[model samples]
Target: MKRIQSGTLRALSNKEEYFETTDLQRSIRQGYASLLSGEIEMPTPFDMGALIGPILNEGTESEFRAELTRRIRRFIHNRHPPLNVDVETVERHLIRRLLRTRKGQTTLSGIGVESSGSSQDWLQGIAPWRAVRDAQKEHSSVLASLGDNTRADIPKNILSHSMASVCGTLSLVPSADISELRSALGPVRTVSERHTQRIVKYLHEHTDWVHKHKSLLGREAPRSILRQRYRAVGMTLLAIWPLKEAIRKWMEDNPTTHLRYAMGQIVRSGQYPSAINDTLARISLIGSGTDGRSAPAGPSGLVTWWQHSA
Candidate 1:
């Protein structure tokens, strides 16, 4: 019989620790076996880092932990029969292990280490982005309903410009004329007169939140809190318009990929979904230079630009 260290056996016997370790070990073993069998090539540690580092670096701590749990659960599901383990249990253990690691410790310490607090408590202490995200979530249903009603009425090109405007990629000066907003649609030939009107109308209606908070817009603290929330409808329009077709095609071809899963969540939201965390994770895994395969040509530039600007 192989000798097992007492600490190792104890770790394995603990249900939460057992599942995480078993799942990871199984994934590593399966990967190696596949490589040896010429079924798949091995990814270098650096490659793995490239696939995960960006998300860890850029995502909120809550997001990072959630994504980590998701990945582990997904990996286990893909490679084996369902484990008789509770999802919450596995996640709790994985989060603890992650926080105890050097990288996790550094990340937590940066936010001011609390001797005792939950991850949510830690997140609450750090950024206002969470508040922005919550506000967006609260409005997602209304935005979704609006899109369902108005999407068919608006032309695609106009929709794209409207979305970009919402993203703040296209400048919308408060003093700008509505005609100026139409002209910002760029040199697209043959824009329908009614469609143009719809775009203008949509922009005005959705951006009313910005005006409501107009006084706060100039102050950094207040503006930052509400900007993303304010842009929620535009973000939804962008996802539903120019990006939808591309995301649909990707999801069809790579149905089980994490990128596909994340994109699916965003698409389903039909509003400015809280997708930055998932998007970062997807980009880390498959975007240009990470996996040596470029993201799907459509919307890749927009996604790249959004990440940089956001």
Candidate 2:
């Protein structure tokens, strides 16, 4: 059995947006399979790191994203306080945010709920740009700029803790699960991680609690305490600088044509079939990469759904 320890594990996301997607060269998460080898057999280790190194080093969008997926997973699963986020809850939040935007569209807050990271990758694949548009708004900056009063009733520790957990949870999802992740990103279908990343980065920027209210009136100690809570998980005030700028820009442009262009770029990346299949073949449609997972299994544990569907 391949162990996670045997390979490099990087869990990362855009700053506080930790663990949006996790892709491992090691296929441990796929399922456990033991080979009945009379003699001990060791499968030669190919450099999965080699597969992702350039992507990491150069940050070509796809390679960078694949690498980002790896780091986020690491951050999520390895944090000190442990993230308790359920992917389902994230999906629910996406839904509520999408639902709320309609009522608040008149106000600047109309664009609060949106997708980020590879979360929107799949949607971008199926229908490209037109499938899901303006489904979620970038509210992180608003959350950050107004961090003082936005969730004032809630403890900074809770807010930071929640975002950290979310970022970490994102790390757990796999690349092939992009579609599953997109479908899970709320009511909107067909999106990409790049889409999710932008939205989330905006959220981190707008809702920067540490940089904003870490020293609010008479709460220096409490602020420190809250900041420390997030720091313990490897998140820091300086991590999301770019995200903040994006939010500021979004704020200036009412219609936010720039933001739309950025989101469109995400959809644009999957213009090739390889990228599309590479993302989709990861889930629902299996049997492509490692262990070419057998056809779907039946209730009786023998018949596969693929047998009928195929």
Candidate 3:
């Protein structure tokens, strides 16, 4: 106002620029104020690596990507404001990161992924003995339901010997290869890396059981039958390996005990009906050795062993 400063005319001529600068300065000051008052919250950087590491360690690449998307969605959903993250975008990022790592590259290479370095740590947790037991269970299930013209059909004697070999090997070494048991002694005796690890775990846990029974259980023919059928044969034998006492008492108590009668006695022993019936069916298949009938006498060694043990 009073002839405003000498160069004021020029400044007024650039009025638009001056006003823009003023607005910018005002915005900066307000931004600082908002920050101090906690109104303009800063975004935290999400750790995509931690989220992706374990997911990559899971089964397949497809599984990893699927899990990644689900997890990212869940993480965003769990946020207070429910972050506006694109799940597919995060999945693509995580997968790209995995593809960059050496371990991830090798794992997704489609060659022995089950035994990859990344998966070995996970596999190490499985018991080798449990693997052997599972394989044995699968074999038993097949044997129990043998059919005509089945390529898996092995002679009863050979099957029995193989079962014994498995028991002896496991009992003595606990980690010996019984891969032959799976293929019925075929040329191909392949075991997956995952199963190999499970066998390793089994050996670790049942080392004591194997050492104690290797000598006694290994030579016993009847024990092979039990091992072939029951998954818990080791524990079962531990409870009642020498059935001399129980057999003697039972013989004295019931001179003319029949398999059917034994089944009846088992049913009346206060156990669950379904359980007892299932057990009786399994036992009757083994048959008792005493009865002169063509069919097995009730309560054979298979029956008596578990009876005393149970």
Best of the candidates, TM-score: 1
Regions of model 3 farther than 4 Å from truth: 1-178, 181-196, 200-232, 235-271, 287-310
Write one digit per residue (lDDT tens) for candidate 2, span 1-310. Answer: 1333445433445332222223542254342222223143435442111222222333434566677888766644343231344433343355445434423433223433122222222222221111112212323324445545444532232123334333322322221132343443332122345554433443344443222112235534211111211221211111111122332334355444533343223324443333222223222231211132342222221112111211
What is the C-alpha lDDT profile of model 1 across 113-199, one tens digit per residue?
122222122122212222223433443443566666675664333233333343322121222233543343332212334654554
- Cα error, residue 140 of model 1, in Å, equals 5.7
Comparing 2 and 3 on lDDT, the stronger one: 3
Off by over 4 Å in 2: 1-43, 46-138, 145-273, 279-310
Clashes of each: 0, 46, 12
Candidate 1 segments whose C-alpha is farther than 4 A from its true place: 1-140, 143-162, 165-175, 188-193, 206-245, 251-310
Candidate 1 at residue 231, lDDT? 37
What is the full ranking by TM-score, best candidate first? Answer: 1, 3, 2
lDDT of 2: 0.30
lDDT of 1 at 229: 30
Error of 3 at 119 (Å): 40
Worst 10 residues of 1 by lDDT: 220-229
Model 2 — TM-score against the truth?
0.19
lDDT for 37 in candidate 1 is 69
